[model samples]
Target: MEEFNLQFSTAEQCLKVIADEKWQEGFECRKCGRTNYCQGKTPYSRRCTTCKTDESATAHTIFHRCRIPITDAFEIAYLVCGSPKMSSYELSRRLETRQMTCWKFKKRIMECIEHGAGLHLFDIPQKSQV
Candidate 1:
């Protein structure tokens, strides 16, 4: 895996990289399948004017719903990408955060990757009674 500069000096840089990856062909309306989306006038985020579908640059990503700072988030991604076999607790230790938070982050990252890999949440098997 390619190593990224673990540090993101500004949130703008993080958003730029995320936007480039998520909206490579420009913003497309998820609801109407139209390429007529534009940045929202409001301070919230972007919106699809054509279909009225709204989205954030962080939508459908591990960074969504995270309260951690952008720099920390980038660090988490870097850690995960670099330490493939490390445990969640190890990650928490490295980040100097709670183990449970790291666990949640790990799970959410897994979910996002699964979604990217075309696996729906419904397709995930439930735990069976032993």
Candidate 2:
């Protein structure tokens, strides 16, 4: 697998990258079938012009409702992706988060990753290191 070096000079940059990747193809309204709604001007907000359902861009991600700044979330994602295996305790220490919070975050992240495991994007085949 290729390594990805995360580069974000600012929280805004990280959020922009995530938003671009998540909605590269554009966003569709959950309420209606319209595909014309543009991303909201707010940093973390997105609005559906068709249904007027304004939503946070991070509404469904692991960072949803998280008190931590978006930069922390980006750092967490990077660390999780890069590590081969990590326990909640280890993650907590690395991220300077509470153990309980780490546990919860780990659970949700693993669930999300598992749910998408079947998809080709996350279905990386195991390779034997020579």
Per-candidate clashes come to 0, 0
In model 2, where do residues sit more than 4 Å from their true spots? 1-6, 39-41, 117-130
lDDT of 1 by residue, 6-79 (tens): 43666777777766667766776667888776676533357887777778776665566667666566766666
Per-residue accuracy of model 2 over 32-112 as CA lDDT, tens digit each: 867777667678567888788876666544556656666655655566666727777887787688777666655555555
- Most accurate candidate by TM-score: 2
Weakest ten-residue segment in model 1 by summed lDDT = 121-130
**Model-by-model lDDT, in order?**
0.61, 0.59
Please list all clashing residue pairs in model 2, or write none if there are none. none
lDDT measured at residue 123 in model 2 versus the true structure, 0 to 100: 22
Best candidate, lDDT-wise? 1
